[model samples]
Target: MSPIANAFSIDVEDWFQVSAFAPYIDRAHWHSLPCRVERNVDLLLGMLAEQEASATFFTLGWIAERYPMLVRRIVDAGHELASHGYEHHRASDQTPAEFRADLVKARDILEQTGGCPVIGYRAPSFSIGAGNLWAHDVLLETGHRYSSSVYPVVHDHYGMPDAPRFPWRTGDGLLEIPVTTVRWGGRNWPIGGGGYFRLLPYNVSAWGLRRVNAVDQRPAIVYFHPWEFDPEQPRVDSANAKTRFRHYLNLHRTEPRIRRLLREFRWQRVDQAFSDELEKACAS
Candidate 1:
């Protein structure tokens, strides 16, 4: 049997731009905060280089406009540069017009900065839900070939429990590749990365990926924020306790955990790792 190749993705935003910090830190003050994204992303680049791995980075246009060279560096390193919306607004918070405009602006900025046609997207904070399924059409119309915006697990902020845990096609023929989750205990548990990677034990996280690879017989998609590796980053004090814990817990350990994960499994960019699955999905 062949090894289970996984899709490793990175969401390229700084510490202050996390969706959980939105309520506490207004967008107007974003420029005033210390920018730590470039440093952390550079760290990710070195780590991936050491492992000989490629990844997909869903980047914000706001970041690209300020650091165009950084976006170019990601492309130079042979990673897929995908859009993460322009201003980091959730689909649920925006009208269809707003979402469409965001998509165009983001795709244009990413393509211009990275010098490659942006082929994928990841909605800010996985915000695509029943109320905003209209965003799917806007995505296809905007020319994205795929999206990794759906998290099948149930979460307080975003999820679609009935959604497929694997890759599937939207009604309009756009491939909707959901973030990884494992079916267990009559619920979809998040195994994709992000808070779950920090909150759970590393062995547990590894086990879930292994199970998804072994039992589900499908490639698991794992994603993390570049900020996860930066434990020295300044903290935001105004967020609620739940949000703070979710964002800050186990930060110092994230880099080592990532190194271990890379050594333990085979991973590549979303398009490369799941090409077969995506081809089958789109054809149907």
Candidate 2:
């Protein structure tokens, strides 16, 4: 099996995204909008099933309430169901109490609907950086076993550049799995995930993944949102130029590239891959 099999993740959100679009799309308007979460998720479920692969779905709680069937479908299909907070709010914007409450509400809803323990988390916008690293404790207290929230690279929005690249224990024993990147000449570059996977040439991304696996000999965690596949999604009228560009950039190519990725790498849910690695670690 390709080593990349061990760390694939899927973020379940609508086309109106969190980080870039939050400033443009007001929270109040979210409910009134036609729900696209299920439609996009169905697209992904079909793709993954065709490849006989599974992944962790970090679902937004708001979407779960509106489309509980989608959450159940994910569980029924043997994918891991996990929380992506009640709303797409940045962890840094929330105080610990607010973050804890938001997470608890999300976890309760996801666990009840999915009929599975929601043990994984990926913060909206990768917002759980050094400023809010203490949020890790809140996550453990709320029953999450691992998080894919930290982006260990310098970016305009979010990153903790010095954070460990692989899964490592946080202060509260929560396993923090930073997204995968390759280090070259002391510079770390994002590989096949999110916009990087979308905007960059496919061959360049493939080589980046291959390089990381070759040097680290560890499974590289890659992530993408379901909304990425919805090329013809209704456009929300908004004024923030940056948000519009980030959300709409390369939407047409995302799904085809993702299909190619599935063919190239063995992919599975993060929790399942982690469990397998843990067993191997013990054996050795």
Candidate 3:
């Protein structure tokens, strides 16, 4: 394992909330889908506990309302509980007003349910980009101290290729931690986890993260969804070929990959991982 400790975070939403299925699954019909997040979260808890690793759960307000016990369990497990928005709406898709409303509602619900201040916010789909920097001001106004919303890559769906690669104070004064990447070929490559972690070979993923930690001498922020850990989750058949491939490719491999990830990296909660930055943000 590397000497640097990385931020391990979970985007706590079910498979149905994935943007790939947004076109097919009506948000209104979300309640009807068989909920698998609780089970998956339990699995994550067990894994983290076994390794004595801590992580942040960027959970949906909707999930906290429906699963207060689960939210409390996350906090009680000594993990950080943060917001992933109220309805899982993308920041890029929402107007500033809408984003503020969602931010406030989600943070409040998470704080109330978890009995802890929810200070971090990760946009749905890593949707905060050049088009929505205003969302950062809105997040600050709504009481979020930091965000892990920008993915520094050139992706078809979501990324800001020009964004800062490490945790930095945004112009808005909120600490903005873009997802981790390895700078090679004069370009930032995605290695921060999520679908990329599942799609890439385990050795490559481990090597990239190790390079980021030991060579760069910086902590990489690693993230994934709870649903990724649950290969048996109900599949959505209506997604297009590209979406299907991006979301479902190697679901069976994700769990073992995560197990390896835990053993290889020194992982800690997002908020705790950036505790100094957080305190500085609060003071300034």
Best by TM-score: 3
How do all models score by TM-score?
0.97, 0.94, 0.98
Local distance difference test values of all predictions, in order: 0.90, 0.84, 0.90
Tens-digit lDDT string for candidate 1 (1-284): 22978999999999988888988898999999999999999999998999898999999999999999999899999999999999899888998898999999999989888889898999989999777887888998899889999888778999999998888888887898999988898999998899899999999889999998898888889999999988999988888899889999999999999999988999899999879766775576
Clashes in model 3: which pairs?
Answer: none
After TM-score superposition, what is the CA distance of residue 225 in candidate 3 from its true location, in Å?
0.7
Instruction: Rank the models by TM-score, top first.
Output: 3, 1, 2
Candidates 1 and 3 compared: the better one by TM-score is: 3
Better of 2 and 3 by lDDT: 3
Model 3 ranges off by over 4 Å: none
User: Which consecutive 10 residues in model 2 have the weakest lDDT in total?
Assistant: 275-284
